[model samples]
Target: MTITQRKPLRPDDIIINEPGDQYSCDSCGCDLTHSVRIKCADPLCEPGDGVDICPPCFCAGREFRHHKRGHAYRVIEINSYPIFSEDWGADEELLLLKGIATQGFGNWKKIAEHIGTRSKEEVEKHYNEVYIDSQTWPIPKLDLQFSVDPAEFQARKRRRIQALNDTPPPPLKHGPVSLPGIHEIQGFFPGRLEFEHEIDNEAEDLVKDLEFGVCLEWDGDQIIEDEEDLDVRARAKWEEERRNPPPPAEKGRIPGKGPMINGINGYHPPSENGSVATRESLPPKSDDALANGTSSGDGDEEVEEVTQPPPIETKESLAFKLSLLEMYSQRVDKRLEGKEVMFDRGLLDYKKMQASDKKRSREDRDIVHRLRPFAKLQTAADYEVFAADVLYEALLRQRIQELQQYRRLGLATAADIDKYKSDLQKRTLTKANHRDYPTDKHPYRRQSSGPDPRRASLVSFGGDSEGRKSNEREATPRLPGSSTGQGPIVRKLPTPLNLANSPSLHLLSAAEQVLCAQLRILPKPYLVVKETLVREYARRGGKLRRREARELVKIDVNKTSRVWDFLVQQGFLNIASDVSSNHASSSQDASTASGSQVNGSPIKDPRPLSSQQNGPAPVPSTSSS
Candidate 1:
């Protein structure tokens, strides 16, 4: 038989034969159940309905309309191997997921049918073992149980809608309505309230006299007019003036044919003619004119003539002028009332107020200046309240200072003052008794014979002679044993050695004191011996044998032996036993050696030992002396 070559399995060769596999390749338009499906993982590429590709198309890196080769892809294999349980393959897990998603979780029979191979009981058992009972489940399980009441929900919804409907709309935008008297002072017009004044009030003056067609015209020397004009000859002279335009008026001068009445350029003194009346020259007003509240002139006539004639007064203009005058008089009256109040309060005296302010402390002025900015923002009522609070705070601070003063004097109250006086008397008596009977601890305390020199010097002088006498008294010194008055005699005794005052003994602890007592050695001498041994031990690299210690303090062997034994027992000195063999030989040789002598005679050991143990005496120079 000829050998047949088997084809190698590609990644696409893993075919998922599950009936639940519904995904198809988007590119080749083939069912994905025969091969592994690849899906575009990019969130932006066909996000709602994801693009899926078969393994063959994916391996070939085919690009669809929305999916590109560069986009990340996720491999979806329905026939993947077992994950949580060996008996359940990935295909069965997928089917179980799909069935639960469609039919809900507790339908075991339907899930088994979807899984195909597993029975209902087996499927339920596997699900419980892998997901519910085991800790390996991927998603956390929540036992949240809640129910909604549709009636209550609907009631709440209706209430919310009703509340929204009942809410009022915002107010409409309009110009602010001023209080009755405010418009006169602020020049605000109530009727035309859009702005403070009419825009371009003088614009009408420019075009009021303009005519659409010329009423008169001139050709050569003859004048002409429109055919509709009945009085063409009457307007002929008027048309000549309009054509010439009077050679344009001079700068800074009004365009007029009349001569200036005064010497000043462009100035016309009020006319002396009775028809053109000046303000000062107007005839006295009649009762009817005054009752009508009209000036002394016809409504159309100019009351005063100067460079230009003023506009004829209308009812509105007269009313506005009268309101302005009334507002001015009211302001004047208010000012007068304020002045009277200031005079009554003596606030009108500027000089006195300034002097008083100058007398105030710098700190007070600084506080006022600092508060001025904040004061400006406050209303009258707010400012009054703030001022009251400030005064209260000042009163509290004053009370606190008084309390502190009383405390410093040891008399915070009337009862405290009585108690303080009694306590002071008792303290004085105790001090006198202590001075009379001195303690033994201070035997050599200086006795006061005369009055204290410092106190004598501090005494007030009655006269020059008395001051000189007090100075002479303070200059004199008293004998040591002599009494200032009939006081008891205090003898000066010799002071004893205070062990507490000893500097060396201060270094020893209670344990060291016990060891020192057992060795019959004073703590000072024991401390000296310890210091010497410690220095030698450290020099010997932290190892000291008994033989070396004995040789180091050989002056008085008995005392040195006691201190050494105490130090060794207290763990201060560590004697190495490794040199025991050499130490024994050295001891023998040391015993044969002569004793150390201060003079010619050899020193003798006070406590004799066996010849095998005896060596040179060990005595620290500090203790031996």
Candidate 2:
């Protein structure tokens, strides 16, 4: 096999060449136009005009006088590629700019002609792309000089002032003023300044043939001269007419006639019998008589009334009014045509439209009512979406309930539920197995030989048998001499028992025992009264009055009063700081009495003494008083 070498590629082969390409390579002296031209990237390498080299020179790594092989280089291919559009050429862009400068902007046809290579549309688009849309292009700033001439400024100011002065004052009445006969024109929209069918639809014909143009001779000087001449002529004519007044003719007479009646000018002569004719007697004028310029009344000096013709309108004014009316008529006709087409197509059927509107309204009302609870949802779509979500949630809740029921029945298929049931069954079996083993931890689990009579009887009763049995056992009558076998025997002693042998008396102090004996109160009753009085004293800020203390002890008022006196005498109750000053001597005496009674004997039975002696027992005088 023979080995063949491939030919080297040229820049022109990759990029199409254009006529405007002018760049040249410095190393090989080759035209760099329409090809990739290499330039030194270093700014200091070549200051203004950088060295350019062809692609071949760049590939060969050839060095020039100003550019070196080591220096970084950038490639430039002028006219080889388009920046915006592929079809546009660089020369065409140059032509576009030249055309804009010569023919001015907006003259797209002339610009396109100048740029013969591109059409007007392409030229306009290219210009806009480069100048308006592209940021790379620089925009020229205009230096506008604004100066107003003194004479022109003064003239403008004067004209403005005159215009302000000429402005009409506001009317006294200010409101929506209705024009007379405005309602006669059907479909007349004042806001739009248009009307329906006009009264003279053919008014445009009047001015159709009239041609208008500027008359150069009608300048200010000519107008003023004409006005002056017209004024002088009018004055001369008025004087001549004033001097040339016609002579008065004979009343109600015509030449070679008897008395003329209703002759010319509708005048009438009087009757020959010297009777004044009444207006009712005069015959009315007929159409023929009016056409012939004559009247019907017969009198000496009376004239019949005649209607005058209206003033004639100018051609221009009449045409303008007619044209406006015609335009309105055309508009009305066009609107009617559209309505007629709609009616013909059955789109404007009143009954069908009304029914459809009512159905739509009913559906809207129903939707609004149904969505009233979800008022936060602004749009119908939002409401519908939310309602669907709610429905889905309800389905999920029902499914969850079904699953829960399945789980409760132990028929669930879920792994967790099955695992839980298995675990529960295992725990139950394990407990049963544990019970069978009879571990020491649960001694009650030991099997009994047989059911007890009490348990058997309790099982036979449906109610709380244990509670009933307990109540019965507690209610069982016991002899006073008998004792319960549970613990120590506690005897029920009489209230008059000696305090030394009383179980409750040992808990009291010596002074409390002595006080109890003196009051003829049992140790229990004495302690109860003492606690009540002390609570009342503390509640009243440590001050217990005699009557208040007696009220607090509800057991026996006389015995409670004695106990209160004993407690007060022993200084057990003291007045609060507020009343302590008044009870200073009493407090001092009670303190001395309490000190002496601290060593008193234990309580003795006071019940027997109270029963034997009717008089009050003598109390100890422990205080100094």
Candidate 3:
């Protein structure tokens, strides 16, 4: 191969570049050689000297007019998908379309019509950015029935029929878990069968090294905005369409499928040899089968009322729990133990029942008139085996819901709080690396370390939340942390458990422990009052009573009397100096003479002071008294 080298000219030959920068040509293939301070506007041109042309061609002068209007274009509004990211590109639009398209493959023709773009090829080429008329997402008034992609959609339907032969998902409690990250296929699913099949097959395939794939569902008529009128309308439309099922695509037409039933909590009928009969073909729901009761949901079928068995005494709770579950499983839905419903031994459903008195026979007109009222469960788990108590079970359920919600909303769970906080702290530290906490090096106390149960929850929850997840293998640690095995981690015990040693005091009141903790955190000045001020504040007849002192102990507030001033000055009161400021100020004003006099010389005031509240105060010489 021969080495090729382009001739280099003086600085004039090359154009220097800065970002937010551009240059362009008069024609598509043109270039410019001359450099100019002005910004180039032609899209086809490259930056260079005054001669505007394609950077390579370097000949045609700039032709495209610059559309500069001084102020940059303000994106006051945009039309976008609600779920799409702020920087959503064009392919996302197509992906979103594929997800929501109702017409299937034929819908591609309307791509230009919907977005006002020129052609399908153009639409795909410029998929990164889709300019919209509105600055913010606008919900279009036009209706498009959403359907699945023809190719994959047909494949999914075929798979669904064949999937009846596939194994069902494992139960919620155990077996190989269908964790979102480890085993899940992201898809636009229609019904429970499709969803569960996807989960089971995808999870198995996932573990077996099958790569993840997308299951896009679309056509436009997906989520109905008017949900109150949705079910009835969708059912009517589905019935109409099902009665006149569309012709095969060889003649060039869309398939008339019924409304989506996935992601809903509803009754599912048994499938026959993988073919689901059209609802139109099925006999109308019998009035007798439904007890002629009113249905809260918009659909025609009324809900069946159920009579619950009487509550059992706590004596045989374990047997009662099993009986109740069995009854509940069999009560309303007989098809529940159907082949599809029952998973293998590890495939048992981790169902929980909560006690509720709301009648299944009630005439409640609310749209969501309770579907099924479960009896109130005493605790989180269904079976409160002697092994798992209320606290442990509640903590576990709380952890699950918290994690699930956090995962769904993409937020930090209580489990991640500490780790997140540490990360945040590190980021903040970077901004102030040289900054220091003045007392860190000193043997000082922390004022912020006041007693708080929330603190205990935070510390305990933070260290142990990650382990609470269902996938977590090890048993939940009863103690605060893995390190707790060696010994109690005093620092992590929340506010030092300062009163934990004082059984009597601990029994006295939790309020007191909290108050004492606050007191421990406060400086001596607030507790100590000057002798004169204390007498004045207390009134002569009121001498700081023992009850009063004890009551103040909760707040760690002290009367600035001879007793308090001495204790404070002697450093008997331990807290931040700012806390003792009140006592110190009072002591300074009252003078140390009062303490000295009480300690040394016998003394009495020459004039007796009296207050309206106290009546008359005595002034006696210590010598005589």
Query: Which lDDT tens digits does candidate 1 get at residues 171-243?
Result: 4434344433334544444364422443344433544453222212233225543645434433453566668
> What does each candidate score in C-alpha RMSD?
39.5, 40.4, 35.1
Worst 10 residues of 2 by lDDT: 443-452
Candidate 1: list runs displaced more than 4 Å: 1-17, 129-625
Per-model TM-score versus the true fold: 0.18, 0.16, 0.15
Clashing pairs in 1: 553-618, 553-619, 554-617, 554-618, 555-619, 556-619, 557-618
TM-score ranking from best to worst? 1, 2, 3
Q: Report model 2's TM-score to 2 decimal places.
A: 0.16
Instruction: Give lDDT tens digits, candidate 2, residues 503-535.
Output: 688879887776565445677867777788788
lDDT of each: 0.54, 0.53, 0.36
Name the lDDT of candidate 1: 0.54
Please provide, for model 3 over 272-380, each residue's C-alpha lDDT reduced to its tens digit, 9 standing for 90 to 100: 7755555565666557744765543456444333323223234355455455556544542343333233232212322211112143223322312332122122222
